[model samples]
Target: MGIETYLVVTDLLCSREFPAEDGRSDLGIAGPGYHTAELATSRGTRVADASMREEVMERFHEEREALAGTLTEWWGEPSHMGLQTIRLRTATEEIPEPWARLSHLMGDVYVWEARQCGRWIVLGVADRDPTDEIQLLLTATETDPP
Candidate 1:
């Protein structure tokens, strides 16, 4: 069996196949977050609809812009107070430090706060290689769960 990678946007997932080079092959990726299962084999990465993708993309852009400003401010100072209280237990173990670094290097990072009780920070890191763009996301645990 060969190692493989996939792409994800929302609940959808897709796998890529590449020509074998040397002993390995390269999988073309379109987005972050990967999943093994398929909604239907025939679908093979078929997007839900142009409208849905657009909506998500729009929200993503809005988020990107918002974070750009927030991160720029955050990077100026090592720390900043979060508006929401995030639960450590519910937090994902994999944090977006690398992405944050990339964002910082790129000149800004995007940060946001949950309305009720958590802080959500997202960092967009474009790979030096123009072909690849990745994002780093992070969240600071809150003392109290809101």
Candidate 2:
């Protein structure tokens, strides 16, 4: 019903510990370095009130920052990628742009890579009004499966 935001992480051996409700079993398509886990949540569960849009956005920012901090602590600084880069890469691969339709709901989408550990982490936040529902996803993987 709503756009889902997926937080994807590649290459870190903790998939067994990920909760089952988070779609860890679905195991979406893997890219180059693929060993991953995913977690998802709906926007309604995040912001119950329509008037709290700003607060909800703030929370998203905090969550993203915390995730980045944790990853950095565990794996060190990350190589960052932007939406444009992702778009270009997808276009080059002839794959449909995953974020095209949900672009309006997105505030910031960050893709971070820890090459030394062969890991990739993606954090996408929905900054739209609370009335519009969205899904948040978190994933960890090794290489992109071809």
Which candidate ranks first by TM-score, i.e. highest? 2
- As a whole number from 0 to 100, the lDDT of residue 125 in candidate 2 is 61
Q: Count the backbone clashes (under 3 Å) in each candidate.
A: 4, 27
- Candidate 2 error regions (>4 Å): 1-50, 84-93, 96-107, 115-117, 128-131, 134-136, 141-146
Against the reference, the lDDT scores of all candidates come to 0.30, 0.45
lDDT of 1: 0.30
**Consecutive 10-residue window with the lowest summed lDDT within model 2:** 1-10
The TM-score values for the models, in the order shown, are 0.26, 0.50
**Model 2, global lDDT:** 0.45
- What value does the lDDT take at residue 72 in candidate 1? 51
Off by more than 4 A, model 1: 1-46, 77-122, 125-146
